[model samples]
Target: MSMIKAHHLAVSYGHGEAALKVVKDVSFEVQKGETFGLVGESGCGKSTILGALAGRNKQWTGTLEIDGEEIGQKRTRSQLAKQQLVFQDPFGSIHPRHTIGRTLLEPLEIHGKDRRQERIEKVLTDVGLPLNFRYRYPHQLSGGQRQRVAIARALILEPKILLLDEPTSALDVSIQAEILNLLKDLREREQLTYILVSHDLAVVAHLCDRVAIMQSGGFVEVATRQQLLENTVEHPYTRILMDGSRGYVSERRKSDSAALPA
Candidate 1:
């Protein structure tokens, strides 16, 4: 069974004539424990789709099912706890005044979960951060370290699915690999499903099992990772993306010494 299913999903901002539709009739399914990717340029509605799925955007229409239960309807706290979103900008996502420990504890407190200290420390360790680091504020950490904490904040709830909106895009290229490896390890260790949004084909290729290419708020093509690797995509937009990825790879080889994790 699909872990996530969206049928003819549409999302927009505002209402009536003032409304600006961002996602148009997009549909897809992601299997349990699989990493499905949405790849596109900025403003193509990739993050908008993720926001709708994560329940951050309520101005959406159509059927969205998570584990066979329809979303957009009122969900129980337990149902809401089954999914979590990890935002792109870690510094922006976390509160500046709050300590890392407080940030991790907030979710548990909201859910009324017990053993908050134990859960916080375990999540910090699971994300490869020292337990002592939790006592520090966001400003005390590096960009990569901040991103790790952001990820830990999401994982603290022990959600079965993660909506990743360009999770590594805000970090340095070198640090991106480390975080990607960390996510891969966490997903395997926790058996979590993911819907990863990224413009970087390399990042998607490195982490996703299947990919959907979005263009102008709609999906242009969907293909397996092997199909993407073999350059067998049928859509023109997908081909353009493939060409751009090749160019990026060529440029990176000359200038970037940091390789994506294997």
Candidate 2:
């Protein structure tokens, strides 16, 4: 079943006549429990699409359906909780002044959910954080740890869909893999759906079952992971992205090889 369906989606900043469109006539479907990726260079409107899905941008116009129900700007609290967004920058997403426990409790409190302590502990464990870390503030945690808290906060509401906007782009290269692995495990355990946006083809290839290549505010091509791995993409833009990712991997491998002991 399609967990998310979007058609003719458009987003613009500013009013008419002065409006600058960022996403133009975009469309796609993400099946339940599937991770769909939007990949492109910066400013390609991938994040804008995520924002629209999360109801962050009311200026958007399109048909957006989540779990078969059409979504609008004025979403009910329950409807809003059905889809959660984990932002790219963990530092920016979390409240520096609030302890991790307080941060996680906010969502539950807003929804009037009981057993806050139990929920907080479970989400922390689910994100691989020690239960005591709940007393720490965002600034006290490492970048990776903060991101884990961010993921935990997003999951505390038990949202079925996650809109990941460049979720790992700001973390250390070594830490990125760990975060990705955690997300993969959590998705399987929770039966969650994902719409992940990123400029890194390698990240998308690792996490997404299918990917859409975006350029100039629209999707240039959409292909399954097998097609991407097999180099079966036909679009020039997608070809360029694939070639660039390959080049980066080759260079990084050579660098690692050169650094090895003789």
Candidate 3:
């Protein structure tokens, strides 16, 4: 079953006399328990599309369905909480002033009045954070730890679908690998449907089952990871991105190779 569906989604940033369409009729579906990646260069409306799914932008015009229910133009808090968005920058997503416990409790405090402590402990354990470190502030934790906290906070409400907007982009490669694995395992255990947005094809290749290539606010190509990386199909936009990424690697290899023995 599809967890989320977006068809002919168009987002405009301005109002009245100066309305500009940033996203141009993008259509896609996110399957349950699978990761659907949205990849594109900066300013390509990837995040704008993600915001539309999370219901962050109200001005967008399109059909958006979450769990078989058509989401209206104006979303209520309860309807909004059924899905969650995990941001690109984990550090920015979490508040420095709030400790882990306080951070995790923020959503529950507003929505859930009972079983707060029990919920906190469960989410913490689920995200691989212990209850003892719940009092630690964001500054006191490592990058991975902070992200885990962010994930915990997102999962505390138990949303069925998570819109991950470059969730691990800011972290180092080693840490990113760990976080990705954690996300995969958690999604499997918790049965989450994810819409992952990133600039790296390699990252998307590793995590997403299927990927959609976006350019200039439109999806020029959609294919599985194998088709994207291996098949090297013939969309001009996707080819450019893949070629550029490969070209960079080729140049880097020559540079590194030149420094070694013949």
Best by TM-score: 2
Model 2 regions more than 4 Å off: 248-262
lDDT, candidate 3, 1-262, per-residue tens: 8888898889989898898899999888888898999999999999998888788888898899989999987888777788888887877889999988999889998885589989999998988887898999999998888889888988988899888989888998899999999999999999999889998887888889999998888998887987765645557677667666555566776566335432
lDDT of each residue in 133-233, candidate 2, tens digit only: 99988989999999999999999999999999999999999999999999999999999999999888889999999999999899999999988876677
Per-residue accuracy of model 1 over 90-178 as CA lDDT, tens digit each: 88999999999999999899899999999999999999999999899999999999999999999989999999999999999999999
lDDT, candidate 3, residue 36?
A: 94
- Listed in order, each prediction's TM-score against the native is 0.93, 0.93, 0.92
Clashing pairs in 3: none
Residue 50's lDDT within candidate 1 is: 90
Worst 10 residues of 3 by lDDT: 253-262
Candidate 3 off by > 4 Å: 247-262
lDDT score, candidate 3, position 87? 80
lDDT for 144 in candidate 1 is 96
